[model samples]
Target: MNTPHTAAPVARLAAATAAIAHQKRWFARMREEVAAGAPLALVNADAPQEILRAMGIPYVVNQWWASVVSAKRMGPAALDSVAARGYPDDSLQYDAIGLGSMDLPAADVPWGGLPRPDFVIAECGADATRKVFDLWAEHPGTEFFPFERSSATTAPDNWWEIVPREWERAYAEDRLDLMTSENWQLVDFLTERTGRSFDIDRLAEVMALVNEQAEWNRRTRDLLAATRPTPVSVNDSIPAVMIPQWHRGSVWGRDAARALFQEVEQAVRDSRAVCPGERVRLMWIGRGLWFDLGLYQRFQEKYGAVFVWSMYLAIAADGYARYGDDPMRALAARFTGFTDQLYTPPLSSQWYVKEARSHGVDAVVHLVADDVPGSAFTTEALEIAGIPVLEINADNADSRGGAAAALEAAIGDFLERRVLG
Candidate 1:
């Protein structure tokens, strides 16, 4: 039996989740068109999606698909699919889970399984990312296209402040040049393969829509941060913000973002609280806890601690905005070292501390994955800034590494000892 709190994900979140269902169904229908020689691309989240939107190519983001697999509790089976292929299931589980799950029986697959991608597009974010996509291309129908990820040469202390407006100065010109050139090459590559002409005007329109959507997200994040008693839960905000994020540059995505902001603003007006007796406010610094979302609400009734923040919503606010004349260059600026600002040492640490203080977070639960770049610095920075942080070492996608009971107990002990103490 699903309670209202559990069954009904907040309204905005419900809309986003429903939109994903609609997208999957639409993908199912689109398969007929794909069979008739329409192109479908499997894209990594960091890749430029605006070009695909403008070119009328349908794309499925790899990370989003992996989250779907994790949430459906098929991660073990998904990893097993990888192990069976002689690949180490433990390595890059977050990025590789969807690839592994591709071989699952139709009934066993989540969301009817992903369609065979005509193109597998990714940036060389890690040593294994391109290789993983290369494996995907080994299937008869798929081909791979990769963009270069430049080394992190610049380390700005307060990235959240500068990235939204002064991004050109924040990142080096050469880095932007490389990404912009690569984006054009991507456009050329897609054009030659799909027989689709790249339209600059259409791309400009997509860029504008992306900016509009991101602005709405910034407003929503500000509204949530300022509102006392937190008008919505992170569990709800995650899907509400993320679904639109994955579909950015579409009109529906822009409307969804605006709708989320309005809904959250309305909730603030109503004094609605997910935890009415809310006491300790927490910040979650890591990926979404897909295996057990209920963990967020677990302490609410017992200790009045409601998780008020997560990187999904916060990064959606700060990470997506870019402004300039050339849409392609601006788009390049958006993704060039995009992940670095979130996970690199000085940039990541500074942003976390700033967010914690601004959100009035009492403590932080930092899930430190081995693959994540600067977990130690993020935690240390928070503690140095007079915030209590409880660091847990585990993969966010694989819950089997640490039992949920143990994880929950550790959190309870942290709250009792460090936070509420």
Candidate 2:
């Protein structure tokens, strides 16, 4: 008989486990609220959710929920639901999974599934994202709100340094103005629909909380970057940083970030190592493989190769944190071209190279999702920096194509031939 693998106690962090438990409880409460006729908002990952947070509206992030669906092994069935509605099942699986899950039977839904949201909000980015959220509006009692997606007219290499205090220079003024106006519009729309009052002072407080949260993440990221024989796994750090990220404007979110920083600090102080044999430190540059998190750990035992960096934790450290006297504009500055930092050329390519060097990574595995832009530039820049690159073309959410085996094989080959050699 074969035995299933279980993580050793030290390999898992209590902070990651607690975050998961808290999210489940939070979701259960959200479901109950919706059942009692409270309104719910479904916002995209790139949309400004702090507005919803400050207004006291209950909300769920579409991408976060999609991650949950994918992690539960329900991605194929959810995609089937989308196809049943005559939508393109193969496109934007990360954003579309939430819409598809709404059609699934209750028994099949993950985490008892998402409650039917009264409002769907997203930035009108890409050709398909608007269409996906539009489809969401077609359901009864659901309305869609969109913010204009603006392109980055200027690229700044040192965004992480300037964004916290001097955001106007990091992003164009016109882009910030438009998003700030739309944020007010969203506030009005929510107020009219839900009869909740908006307070600018309250928003300022929320923004401060979010910035504090980002600072803690920065500390954790810096600690991990400077540590050798990496202290924590990317798997643990992802949830530890990202679960609280979905609740960014709250006290709990700020504290969660602090807890993660403290936990990693303690681990470092104790000299805990994910791979004590630690020959290679690798970077994962894409959406997490939600269905196969174990992929992060697979090479550790055989090759002493550990995935020490992922964009989830790294972006949380460097991408968030906007400070300004005007709360609404600061919020706008935070989201306008936010995706550009990770997906636009020059900016995306530059940041990835910076992160690679800072983390001291020997190699990178860039999971190339079809929906993400400027991927080629990102891969090329890392190569120019003298980092060995392994490109895997795969959907981070869907597992339907039997691609996992091929992906694993490709990575193994890359490790043996390029990285290990």
lDDT of 1 by residue, 384-414 (tens): 9999999998777776756577779999999
Q: 79, model 2: CA deviation in Å?
A: 0.2
Weakest lDDT window of 10 consecutive positions for candidate 1: 1-10
What TM-score should be assigned to candidate 1?
A: 0.94
lDDT at 376, model 1: 89
lDDT of 2: 0.90
- Which candidate number has the best lDDT? 2
Question: For each candidate, how many residue pairs have backbone atoms clashing (under 3 Å)?
Answer: 0, 0
lDDT of candidate model 1 versus the reference: 0.84
